[model samples]
Target: MLEWLAGGAEAFIGVFNEGGKVFIAFVTGILPTLIVLLTAVYAIIELVGEQRVHKVARYAAGNVFTRYTILPLLAVFFLTNPMAYTFGVFLEEKHKPAFYDSAVSFVHPITGLFPHANPGELFVWLGVAAGITKLVENGTAPFSLAKLALFYFVVGLVVILLKGIVTEWITKIIARREGVTL
Candidate 1:
């Protein structure tokens, strides 16, 4: 009974220590990389000029396939996750949801190559790659994580297209049935 009480205090202290370590690790390890990457991308966009960017956005807005695949993939991957939704401002109100869906779907697939894309869930991608590496070393599986990462990106884009198209059609159908225009 007393030992249980002692254990509770120890667990609480351990949690506090782990929280401090996580904070330090993130500040030192992740923050600088994130800053550099974000700065570099925005700089390139500036160099590319507003007209070129707007032209691409317009082209993507006009097509279901481009709207779902290239638009979200570029925005989500380059702009990072949150502002990727901000990029949806170019899209119509109806396409916004599908845009969000596609953006979110692309995050996980890109993680195979860019783990910083979903830094909080770092272990999810790292764990899978590590497991595959171990298996290949043991001859239990014959796979290259690098190749898998590339395939993951391709499949993710295809899935985003399929999901976006299906959701966009369903949304249009519902709107039409409700006597609304999209």
Candidate 2:
């Protein structure tokens, strides 16, 4: 598995690293996107089966699930792993010099993949996008990619709040139907 990743990364890089960072970038950025998609789908299933709020379920499953936003956040975490270990182990055999090159190189702005853009940069941008999305939905601000990324953490916070309330209600109902007491 490890050997294939390093050697095979050049092929898969296109899907995850639109910015082209590849290596750890693909793992952190791309893999997490998959997780988000999976999670959104899972959330939807939970809501539907539990008979929770349809709107939240649909939004999470449909819009958020499909949206490309999660990828950036994933990328951020993916890149944090040691560059050499990530790229060398997975994408290519350890080339000490190339490992250093990837670790230090900054990603290209237009490409987003890179020369080797820092994952942190993409993370911040995604965070901004998330924040902006929240602000827009809440009537707090206008839509803007940067703003959304800036507020992404807040957006997640808001989502969590909403999810908690809704999930709690669902749980209580289910408990009642099952003849269980709170």
Candidate 3:
């Protein structure tokens, strides 16, 4: 029992050390980027009053193309957390539950596709593209880096569209059932 307990404690310490290293690495890598992005976003919001921003958001929400395609594409191509914060603020200010639901659905997948607006994302995307090309290369492999990026882009767009549409529909149904206007 003593030997077993000692071995378990040793293994636990090793795992904890490794986990701490990974946590430190992730924080060091992402903290600066997050700080800069958040600062810029907040600065812009301050410059362009909340009311004006909400006006723009309302306009975007009214348009299907802008709401689904353009916004999601921008969010994915840009940084994720910053866009998420901006959208969250917009939702809060606008007080439109449907818009909030739809935007959340649209933003998350794009964030997943392109986590950071860094070269690392591009490299990872390229590697995945190469792997996919190798796997599917029967005749001439049509999986160029651009094509792979585009495919993921389209996938993100499709996910946003589906989620936004479904969420909006469900929200409306629930609102109606509760005798409330969405």
Candidate 4:
């Protein structure tokens, strides 16, 4: 069956009103936390000094654990996805591709626990969790959004770590044998 539309100025007005509600919700629910988080990241970066960050990046580039895990994790969380790629500039030619693999893979996984990490892709987390949330509200499921977020966060980290390691190893082998086509 189909429903009828208001079919006039009223329908247009109604759509705008609903859009306004979403904008209001976003401003109230996510904006403050995002502002504070971004501010803190910038403040910490400023206080720590770019020179120190570069030194750490150079140091981190040599070790697999630091190279793939700490560096990527920090860069992604510190600068957030696209901007995080800037950190790769500090790495050697061989390490840059591997570091990028780790950094790029982390953007979505991080949104669960830190929505601000990929705020533009918040729907990735929320869309999946929405069904469970409805079930919980209806008392049909035992899960909550906090639990789900935490679960996703932990799993995401694990996946990122594994992906980073494997990709780095593969990249090394490929570059050595095939001239960095990978």
Winner on TM-score between 2 and 4 is 4
TM for every model, in the order presented, reads 0.75, 0.26, 0.56, 0.80
Clashes (backbone N, CA, C under 3 Å), per candidate, total 0, 28, 0, 0
Q: Give the TM-score of candidate 2.
A: 0.26
**Residue 2, model 4: Cα distance from true site in angstroms:** 14
Best by lDDT: 1
Q: Against the unseen true structure, what C-alpha lDDT does each candidate score?
A: 0.81, 0.41, 0.56, 0.78
Q: Find the 10 residues in a row with the least total lDDT in model 2.
A: 106-115
**Tens digits of lDDT, candidate 4, 55-79:** 8878877787778777877787888
Q: Which tens-of-lDDT digit does each residue in 1-182 have in candidate 3? A: 99999999999999999889766865786556655765675676689876776676556655655665555444334434335435534332223444445445544344324435433343354446557777667556655545666676677667766666666667678877898753
Tell me the deviation in Å of residue 54 in model 1: 3.4
Model 1 residue runs over 4 Å out of place are 1-35
User: Which one wins on TM-score?
Assistant: 4
Q: Whole-model lDDT for model 4 versus the true structure? A: 0.78
